[model samples]
Target: MTKTTPQTNRRIVLASRPTGAPTADNFRLEEVAVPALEEGQLLLRGQWLSLDPYMRGRMSDAPSYAPPVEIGGVMTGGVVSRVEASRHPEFKEGDLVMAYTGWQEYAVSDGTGVNKLPAGFAHPSHALGVLGMPGYTAYAGLIDIGQPRPGETVVVAAATGAVGSLVGQIAKLRGCHVVGIAGGAQKCEAAVKELGFDACIDHRAADFPEQLKAACPRGIDVYFENVGGAVLDAVFPLLNIHARVPVCGLIAHYNGGTLATDSAAILRRTLTQRMRVQGFIIFDYYVNRPDLHAAFQQEVGNWLKQGKLHYREDVVQGLENAPEAFMGLLQGKNFGKLVVKLD
Candidate 1:
């Protein structure tokens, strides 16, 4: 069924750059008239908006891989949206697409980077989570950089989260023993039981480091680094000789906290153990890689359909509540892949 276009578009724009943790004051909600679509452009109504940890880096003007969102710009993000009006030949009015339309209710795209969703694609929001960027991050980092061998022990922080959950599961598929580090007892339990992690330790516990060490008796062969602060400190000593580390996100220090990095100690470990610590952005693998996307979707998608993989989403309703939900994400209040459902 074709959808009617709304006259007004509701958007959450960056009011001011965040100094530390982003607050509600840093965002401004505005209702503006939707502009007329040009020829070859399609009007999109956002259905699901992804809120990820990487967006935290974009909030600041720090020297990073991608440029920061300028003041008054719509907060940048990926969205699963429906085409309401299409002048583009490739898309129809009722077609679903995965677009980088940010945090706005409606947007117009000329099919530059938009991907038409597969017909009967189950769980469209999975495009923003497990079957999308987060899933690719986990797969590329673990397989290419991590190089997990059979019988190796792999550990990942944020075990119940979007990327971490898949990291652990894929490691298991590669015949490695997978251990997870999560925030609370409940998340830890879910990680072990639901996600098929061999063991999961609670990071909030008093002796978190000790608990992690105990779980991985053979030492960590690969450490998927999502949280950098205390978790890295704990994982450091447990890393076996020649262990690989794929640094993805640092959610622990994203809201203004020092990463516990002793240059001398890190160098000492690097020299003595011959360990490899590599930082990678998923976009690097994704760019100009139709082969990678096909391989990932075929392998991971099959596993998901076969019940070998699991995903969770912490969805908050409405575009207006995005600021509040995003703030809670920085504080570890989100249970899984955090997304805002624009109603």
Candidate 2:
């Protein structure tokens, strides 16, 4: 009997689920055999794997927009990878592409839903950050529903994060007075001074609600909800009549706890105030996205080139750290977009 030699493939799988905040023990790293390429498929060596708050929804056993990750299964994520071998006609060895390759050092894909990255792109890892899913989410959610306008007051929480940062910048471009809410002093400073937000308040402050209220004395015309627990509480009373809210993420509640019961009252206020509030998953808007996505990418890409749109990345080296790094995301420990690098 012949034994097959295992090729290099490292994976991080769900070890166990947390009742609340996830910990290192929730993920188990294991060695697996590199997959053989099949027809129209390519073997990818992951370059960068994005760690996002949405992954927390997948970890829980409760129902959500996406299914929960089964215990002992590999955690799912978007990845930037280089083609190591290809049986597909369109891809070749060394071609860099973006895919949903999850938390692994190796993956195999049949080229469907893959974007061939532009050659000489300075940061291939960017496919998981500013130019990628998070960016698109901010673009679509804010535009299709929120419709941020000139001279309006825009308030967004998680202001230093991937989606929230772009939301602030795009709103600023519309001539809005943008106020950002972040977790700490350092992040608040960067949100205002670095990203050009009109003002930023630290949610960690002892009197955060008052500070946020002070920053938006004119009341909020648009509320981009990113961290939707206490921060929502602060922003609620400040929402102006006919305000628009585009609900994208609720990172503060990702740990499986419900917010205070009074949160339901905000919907009543929405009805009485005639506000337009909508919750959305970006992927839902992709079918009608070409026009907006192109416009957003062009403008945002230019801003990036001109040193206007700023992005911060919390990079942790190796696939091995994905579990711990993801734990940090749920706890707001990540200062910006989090990505894990693997050779």
Candidate 3:
């Protein structure tokens, strides 16, 4: 295959920090000449870009685990790219790789953080979803932190989403009764039917809390905390003694929301119940436990092949539409793992 090199690279950069929810105005698209690659470097043409809730935190200059994106820097993201050209000894042209190439059409890399996609991999985009970071996050957080046992009840918020879907499925495989909390009738239905969750409650219902309680007759032994705010409020009272809560994300509170005011009550309940609530970032596990990643790849990869796991992607076409699609994601408009297919 003859790979064509583009002269110009189009990228989306942070125009300004957002006050509340991010808008299209917060991102600016600009085209610039692709830089010439030096020796020991490679040029990448992006095929897919991942848009996740964590990106919202990076857009702000607030204190966080990772540094915020600079005013004029390309918005940070993970990309699956094809090596259009390479002068590096380790990598070759025509190789498919996963890299932190941000929101750009083209990138130059020294291969520091690039991982070559395994040959004959059926889906390259799955490297950004189920078989990648999100899948690992679901597996490690639930199995290691949540530690669900047989016949226990597990409740997952954002049930049909990228991480939550896998969390629920993995819990079921461990012999637990899985209940999911999702928005709207359609998502709730899919959670139960498609994802094999025992029961799914629609959070938009007026009696959502009541429905969640009804679904979990044995009380929640493991609560996979994906959406905070109202969902957290509903799950808090139902946590059984010695319940485990793996806090993977707080998507509801990501867009400058008010802090929960009932901390005293929460602490009191935690004391009485002897609950275990731990927050985790996937990057930590990558650094400290390479073995877990290997296990995840083997176990989850096998489950996927055996038709025991389900994955979904809410793909948006064109780089120009990424800003609007991202804004919609914050509002719960995206139905699955959000990714952009670069033109």
lDDT of 1 by residue, 1-343 (tens): 4544578999999999888889899999999999888899999999999998888888899899999999999999999999889899999988889988999999999998899887767998999998999999999899889999999999999899889999999999999999999989999999999999999999999998898989999999999999888889889988899999999888888986764758789889977889999999999999866687788988999999998898889999999999999898887788889998985
Candidate 1 wrongly placed segments (more than 4 Å): 1-4
Query: Model 3: how large is the Cα RMSD against the reference?
Result: 1.4
The total of clashing pairs for model 3 equals 0
- TM-scores of all candidate predictions against the true structure: 0.97, 0.94, 0.98
Best by TM-score: 3
Output the better candidate (2/3) by TM-score: 3
lDDT of 3 by residue, 1-343 (tens): 3755579999999999998899888999999999887999999999999988899999999999999999999999999999989989999888999999999999999999999998777889999999999999999999999999999999998888889999999999999999999889999999999999999999999999899999999999999998888899999999999999999999989986653539998899889999999999999999999999999999998999899998889999989999999998888888889899995
**What lDDT would candidate 1 get against the real structure?**
0.91
Show how many residue pairs clash in every candidate, following the order shown.
Answer: 0, 0, 0
Candidate 2 residue spans exceeding 4 A from truth: 1-6, 261-264
User: In model 2, what is the error at residue 211, expressed in angstroms?
Assistant: 0.9
